[model samples]
Target chain A: MRENLLDVENLTIKYKVKNGNLFFNRYREFKAIDQVSFNIGPSETLGLVGESGCGKSSLARAIVKLVGLDSGKVTWLGKDWTSSHASTDRKFRENLQLVFQDPLASLNPRMTVSEIISEPLENYRKDLSVLEKIELVKKSMETVGLSTSMINRYPHEFSGGQCQRIGIARAIILKPKLIICDEPVSALDVSIQAQVINLLKDLQKRFSIALLFISHDLSVVKHISDRVMVLYLGRIMEIANVNDLFSNPSHPYSQALLSAIPIPDPIREKERKRDNLVGDAPSPIFPPSGCVFRTRCKKSTNICSIKEPREKIVKLGHRVACHHVSDEESK
Target chain B: MNRLLEIKDLSVVFDTPDGSVKAVNNISLDVDRGECLAIVGESGSGKSQTFLTAMGLLADNGRSAGIINLNGSDLLNMQRNDLNKLRGNRIAMIFQDPMTALTPHMKVGEQIREVLDHHQGLGKKAACEIIREMFNKVNIPEPDRRMEMYPHELSGGLRQRVMIAMALICKPDVIIADEPTTALDVTVQAQIMDLLNEIKTEIGAAIILITHDLGVVAGIADRVAVMYAGSIVESGEVFDIFYNTKHPYTLGLLNCSLSLEKKIDFLEAIDGHPPNPNNLPNGCPFNPRCKNVRDICREEKPEIKIKKQNHSSACHFELGVK
Candidate 1:
């Protein structure tokens, strides 16, 4: 069996919010991530999908040590590195890279494309000379489909798609073992989004790097990911292989999310029955008592509201967190 | 033949430091009563600018030349005050971002009341009654409580519902929804699309939906018009545009979208990015990226020509008959 490259165990993240102005100062903790756990094997793409404010971004940030974890551990290559000091550790920073959403906003406006792509090498590779760094930058640019001639151009000069290519080039420059891409193509147009998705796939195959792909768009996730994980209100609802999760989703939330996506084909779209979950996601600050998704879940019952469902292995690799689903599987 | 809104040879130009930017080129289309016409394009494709000109909402530096006729009356030449009277009364516009479109300081109920007061000259009690009904029609729960809340206090989906309510409060003949559901999540987007479909059938108002999502367009729009670099490359029935595509750009868009039906190994992405509006290619804006480009494509621009019944394509050659 292939060993896991990254393992997250019972990871919990929280943010403190200050309520009641002026005289009475009251601070409350908002639990953004609730004991979420998953693992990614080397060279595998694990797609994390959830709606806005569902803690997908919080979880990604927590993994990279960009955000503090209140509880639990993040194991990298079978080594525990959950301490605050890990953020500054050279080995951790070099092996784990991140590609952000809003390509233009993520890149430094004043810096040239070359500077942005080679910034990692400057920090991590002190042994390399300036000339070597320049050569590496050029090669990285070519790998991401950017011409070396445009290396001196600023982020504002390039289009959104090209700007995204620059972002990809920077993430792949260090040849990291794992890269977490947070909504990388959501800001792009449909045609341009396809270009960036294809580029990521190509780079992944070439470098054999594991990816923690986070996105709200399910169709894009389905296209690029090897395995998929569904999150609802900061908790894992289901995780399985790409085909098994999409074809035979065990969790109710997974089924609703899949049905909500409108297929491009008109005839198929018309025939598809949509079981849309009503109402917006509840605020994480005041989430439902038992299950975080009980407020919006269609299949919720008294047991779903009384006690939180434990994660159960439905099949060899598929795991789901729903009381009814697990009961049916056991029966 | 009973077209409620007709635009003829319309062009929008904006004066900028770089030069005059042709936002929307000479394009003509019409919408019949109770029909939905979708304008699909990427950013800067001028889908939004087309209706902005129709509503007299273009910026000060922008200039438009064409006939915008509504019910046989030319709107381009009308006075600002006259146009203002017709705007919320006869034609209503729903913006992409409902939060910004709505008044933040004012209460949600008062915002809708202001529209009815200005357009219909209704009394306070009458307007309040209509506002409550409008809120319920759009499926906003607890109309009384929601009406008292501020715009920021509501969720994205509810804010959009309020925008739809305000648009419907006027009972306008033409409803132009510009990317109404783009800011919403998938489930909420489905809800909003379903709401729009319900409004189209019940109110029988001509709806013009401006969006980039082809899936949303296919589900709701009766007809589809595709734009590329300020020109309509193709306009047809939804079935024709999706299945029997003509323009290369349109084909590229359909091919590029990741399908939820089946997994595709490699997406056939369009070769290059969209051309800069300031420095578009001479003949056809899409010729540089077209796979079947010929010598003539770089010399003469092709006008939109009808290829089949209710289907038009702006291409030099027939799609499949090279």
Candidate 2:
């Protein structure tokens, strides 16, 4: 049996917003993520996908201890790490890393590529000799398709795609057990995006590193992920295997999200039933009561507005959170 | 068929301290009224520069050669005021980032009204009424209520709608939407694209859609021009570009594109990054990345050749209906 590498339960993150007022102290709570739960086994990928302000980034951040979680339990290697997991052991920190969206901005402009790649190694592995650290950095750089000769060049000298390669090299230099990638290829062009996605898959296989891939691009999430989870306004809409989720979506929101992706094949695009979502996503601060997606859902009803729908397993390993799914099951 | 806009051998080059960068190679294409033309390419492919040069919106250091005739009026040699008059009044453009395209301080209604005020010389009361009508036309709920809000007050999707409203407010004959939905999410992108198409039909305006997403191009464009290294390597109808591609670079791009319909085990990525405009390679410019690269491709450039009715491609090898 494949052992679970990391398990997250009931993860919730909220922020106190001022609501654009300075004189008054009236604040409202914005639930960035609510009761989100998932697990990743060794060398597995769990893709978190949603639009902006859906809290996918916040959830990834919370998992890496970059942000405080309002409520949740993070279990790593059978050990529990609560909301305030900062100041934890360095081993835990070394085992988990993150790759951001903007490659150029994520890297340091002043630091040389070699220095930047080895910075993590210098911090985590104090016992490793300088020659060993250099060797590891060189191996990682080559692994991400970066040339070993241009190690002395700065970030500005490289293109957007090359800078992202350097970023990947740094993330994997420490040989972390898990990596949370936050829209890593969103800023890259199509050709460059393919290279980076393939590199991540290759590295994961070679090193057995679990990945938590968060992206607004559903197509990209589908390309590389083994299991996909759809998030809508701080909540999980559906979680299923890649084939099942794309083949048959249970939730209305998931259905809309899938049908909305523009198919590259013109014939399929013309024939497919397209559900064009009208109106914008409501403000996360004033999200509707009960089901957050009720306002945009076609299957919404009085029951949907009164109570948040519990997750229902419609098939093996396919869970959907929608009142309509429950109604069909009851029928 | 009447040509709404015509370009003859248009090229744009920018002068930098390092060297003169040929951002746009000589290219000529005509747009008909009520037709959607898509210019598809990766970064540094000169897709945006071609339109920006024609619109007289190029940077100060950039110089463009050739003729841009809008209704037989020479835009390249026209007076500054005359060119300015033609802009936004007859040829409106929608940018990629909606927030940056709009003024942060001004209200949404005022921004739309300002366009009408400057172009049509209409009074505030009259402009505001027209702006409200446009807001409703774009499907923004509570048009009056949302109009008073500032640009940042609205969400990304809402801001894009306002941009579309402003662009269509003038009722221009030609609309150049340059990566307008790139910053938007998929769901909102679909909504905006639907609105754009619906408005295009209602207004009968020619839309020049410049984007990199093949899916977007396949779905919306009637004709597509595939660009590579500051040149148009292939030009054809949408069906030909997708179903019967004729260029090696275009074939590479189609394989590189991720499709939700047909699932492939691995995407075939074009090996190298887009060439730097300042130092483009010799000969075909795409020879380095071309899969079927030949000895002749490395020695001489290939001109755009007509292979079928309304379809042309630049390549040294045979390519058609593969």
**Which whole-number lDDT from 0 to 100 does residue A14 have in model 1?**
88
lDDT assessment of candidate 2: 0.88
Chain B: TM-scores of all predictions: 0.98, 0.97
Top-DockQ structure, candidate number: 1
> What's the TM for model 2?
0.98
List iRMS (one decimal) for every candidate. Answer: 0.8, 1.1
CA lDDT of each candidate? 0.92, 0.88
The digit string of per-residue lDDT tens for model 2 on B1-322 reads 7688888898999999998999888888889888999999998899999888878889999999998888778989989999888889899899999999999999999888888988999998888889889888888889989989999999899999999889898899889999989999999999888887787688889999999998888778889999988889999999998999899888888887887766776788889899998988888999888777778988998998898999998887776422
**lDDT tens digits by residue: candidate 1, A1-331:** 8789899999999899988789999999988999889999999999999999899999998887878899999888877779737445667778899999999999999999999999999889979999999999999999999989998999999999999999999999999999999999999999899999999999999999999999999999999999999998899999999999999999999998988888888888777777878989888888898988888887889998999999999888899999889677678
Clashing pairs in 1: none
Which clashing pairs does model 2 show?
Answer: none
Candidate 1 docking category? high
Tens-place lDDT digits, model 1, residues B177-204: 9999989889899999989999999999
